[model samples]
Target chain A: MHDAVLRIAGLRTQFRTRQGTVDAVSDVSFDVRRGETVALVGESGSGKSVTALSVLQLLESTGSIADGSIVFDGRELVGLSEKEMRDVRGREISMIFQDPSTCLDPVFTIEDQLVEALTIHGTARSDARGRALELLRMVRMPDPETRLNAYPHELSGGQRQRAMIATALALDPQLIIADEPTTALDVTVQAQILDLIRTLQAETGAAVLFVTHDLGVVAEIADRVVVMYAGRVVEQGSVFQVLKDPRNPYTAALLASMPGAVAGTGQRLTPIEGVVPSLLDMPSGCRFAPRCPHAWDRCHEADPPLAAFDLNRESRCWLEVDGAVDGVGTAEVVG
Target chain B: MTTVAEQPDAGPTGGTVDGPVLEVEHLTKHFPIRTGLLQRTVGHVRAVDDVSFHIDRGETLALVGESGCGKTTTGRVVLRLIDPTSGTVRFDGQDLAEVDADELRGLRQRMQIIFQDPYSSLDPRMSTADIVGEGLAIHGMASGQAQLDRVTDLLEKVGLSARDLRKFPHQFSGGQRQRIGVARALATNPELIICDEAVSALDVSVQAQVLNLLKDLQTELGISYLFITHDLNVVRYIADRVAVMYLGQIVELAETEQLFTDPRHPYTRSLLSSVPIIDPELARATVRTPLEGDVPSPSSPPSGCRFHNRCPQAVERCRHYAPVLVDLNDGRQARECPEYRPEPFGLTAQSYRESELLNQGTEAGE
Candidate 1:
């Protein structure tokens, strides 16, 4: 595998709410290698977005990184000063949000925004416009000349998202964190955007930390998959390994619940019962044990570590403990 | 006549009416675009233009399209939530357009709507019991303990416990709020429910639970649905029949299986092929026939076929003349100009020739 571009280890983020200190992300670890897309897949309240925010150190005033290190390009991002981190944010790493309408300034033209991303990173004013145009063309936005002068509102959802991607790539950052970039788009437009991200990743060789709840998009783009459940990593592996044969019961239930394109119309999706519990008052043991079909006494007693299940796969489940006797019968535990 | 017994056995099952439960013919809804201090009507934003479809009793007929395709307008018009500029919406053998105020109020009980955003759709200040039982109170169906019992039952039916009745909408999660929305919609015992992107805002797991709940409700209650959504996967899973709309018109309609397997419209083909499959291998192997450009504005749709500007298989005929919906002998149908009808495999005449050559080569190898 290529050298890791971004590595997050033992990441624990906490928010000081009125009730108490809430642990948003707990002991979450993942890596995005050069030129590879690592998908952070989880439902809401699973801490995937919090993990992304912590890496960029963009959490709100009340929220802070309580533990762990975020190493990006051989430097620890955790303790960096605000001024220093600002330099690293757009220059080395860029983040794209789910809603393009909210992120892009309403008054400014597409040109102004793209130029600002470049110029703010110390690119020459004269050269910024040309680089902006080049990036826009790379993203395959139609009528680049006229579009550059158009406001964000004038562009369609798909077009605006393409512009957002262009802005993210303006400085040629090494790592791009896209949090549900295509969730707001239609399926067809989503496919186009996903394709654009993949093509750009290959050309720029930039590692992408794609955070989304959609499993279909994960299958389309991710080289590796990391499943988070209630502020912790439950499973991590290559895209195919994690999707095709998920080790964690949560991962399995999630896949089963998703309505596959090829599944017969008569097929009944197996829903994972219950909602994700609140982060403030999480379960004592496995966060997903409350919903896991194969959950046993051991699962509810203590949290399972991300143990190696296969050559390149890790699963956080009691059922993944090799040769260990489970609460149910003498069945050998296999991930 | 399309009978109830001949319907596809998937998702939900019950005996449908002889014809359709809700039939919308030549539907058109145009919002006036005005200007100046006087606010004189300048032109019409043709939100839904000459669209038509039907939903059978206990059947799910999904209206699938991009954002501005006017599927929501069609649904609203069917339920008479908004008065249509033109067309006939016949619900349960009564022409909704011709109904009086009192009759229309009664008809409202037979056709409810579940909106996409559960939080906003619900009144945050109202307790769950009050929100769910609002329909019953409006219809004067029950009062006091009887209404409370009905509300509790409805909540339980939608997967919420009775204890949740005292809580406010703000106390529930997105999924729970949606379930509450479902309970509210079902409170009136509607025969036809307009699910306007009801599950689109939910996560996949919660989405499954809700979809299953809808199916189970249909089977148990024999309620029909006009399922409007942009998510094709959800449409395929929940809809018995699918209608693909583009720029305010339905370009294709067919049984869900037939539509997904062999779509007969160029736009439908593009839309189907563009959906991201969950399997990495299948996604990588599949060839994409991407539609160019975004959906044109409904205010000023394209001259001939609204989809001609973005369609990959556009021709001179398609550019000059609009196509009417044509039945292709089988259960499938598509809106195509007679001169430029899609071939059996849904490819353009030019591409059909190329596919034929490829097929011949494969057959020879076999």
Candidate 2:
């Protein structure tokens, strides 16, 4: 296997609510190899975003990494001081968010934001402006020279995203964490941004951890995928293994539910028949037991560990545990 | 160019006329921009500029476009929630503009609208019964025990139960709240419903449930939906016909399958190509002809063709002459651009090829 740029094991992120504490992410593990893109895919309430935020230590005040080891570039980051983590954030790791409108300050110009990202990381002020302009050009921002002086509102949604990407790449960090970066933009503009990101990542040879709810976007960009259900990794494999022949019932059901997956119109989508369990009152056994179609009696009574079913492939299901791969096949047939 | 006068009158002008459930002709809705202390009209934002379409009984005609393309305005104008600056809307053989206040109120019983955000669309403090029964109360259709029973029935139809009648909007999940919104829209027994991005906010699994519910309702109730959204995948699944809108105009109108398999307009082709294919091999193999620049501002839109600035096939002549919707005689219509040509194979064919590759991969793995 290629050297891992970032390795996370047994990550547990929790938030304090008025009622009690809730585990937003629990016992999640993944690794992003050098110069490859790994996608964390799930629907809302699935903790994909929480996992991304936990990696960057950017969780809200009510949330914290209760347990985990986030080792990036051979260094542990679970309990780093704020001052030390700040030094590691922009220089070695950078992050992009879904909505650029909220991420970029409305009062600052694009040039000011990019330059600040560089200067705060100890780049000389004299060299920052030139590097900022180059970064904008690298992101393919139209009229980069004029766009530098424009505020966040002055740019379109797509352009604002480009500016955000420019800022994220200002330091040429070794790792980039993008959480639904193209989700807010229009489809045509999203195509442009995806192309730009793929090109730039190739040029820089940087590892990427992409978080998104859309499987279509994951198919377009990711090399490996980790499917999350509720607050745990239900499946992890290469994009083809996970998408085409999913061994996990949750992943298979998710693919079957997409409107685009069916061939023709008038075909009823195979919808998973229940809502996600509430975090405050989670089920005792499998997190997806209530909604899983192939779940048996044992599935409702015991929590399945994430066990390796094939080389570099893992599935969290009693079907894999009991050597009942035919159960997953039956689920696919029903789906 | 065929002007509004030259076009056939699809509207209901006389008695016993058999026409579409809703017909909008030359619809133009422009919001004037006021400036300075004078508050004078300086310019106009052409939100819905000379758009036209119709929804037949039990049919869905999706109006699709990116943000700021005036699709939402078109939906509102069709229902007369916002008055059009020009042109006419005819519903069930009666001109909306010609109806008096009393007559319009009576006519509104057969039309309803469902919004995108269930959180904001439903009244927070109102219980599910009150929210669903508001139309019955307003129209004097039912009252007391009868109204409660009807609300219960509507709830059951939308996959909710009678137990939810006492719950408020905040008590339900996003999907359940949307189901309540659907029940409220169905409460009036409306023949036509304008669903503006109704399923856009839900998760994929929940979205599938809602989409299936909408399809089932159409089958059972024979209701026509003017479904407005930018998601083409949803459009393909739900809409019978689709009208692709650009900067305040209909650029292409065709049957859903025809539009997907053989798009005639450059803008439509690019838009279809831009949607990410769910198959990894297909997504990588497809070469996208992406539109270059951002959409031009609606207030100061580009001259001639609104899409020419970003169109990959734009020529010098496209910079001078505005295009009109040209009927293709097979129930398909595309804007008259110099570069309009029919391709034998498109994105759908590309998808088929990739699926073939996937089947081979599966066999090899076995």
Best by DockQ: 1
Candidate 2 Cα misplacement greater than 4 A, ranges = A263-266, A326-335, B1-17, B341-366
The digit string of per-residue lDDT tens for model 2 on A74-188 reads: 9999999999999888788999899997679999999999999999988999999999999988988878899999999998888899899898888889999999999988898
Candidate 1 CAPRI grade: acceptable
lDDT (0-100) at residue A161 of candidate 2? Answer: 90
Residue-level lDDT of model 2, residues B69-91, one tens digit each, is: 99999999988899999999999
Residue pairs clashing, model 2: none
Show model 1 residue runs off by greater than 4 Å. A322-335, B1-18, B337-366
Model 2 in CAPRI terms: which quality? acceptable
Residue lDDT tens for model 1, A92-159: 99999999976799999999999998898888999988888898899988778888999998888889
Query: Residue B86 in candidate 2 has what lDDT?
Result: 99
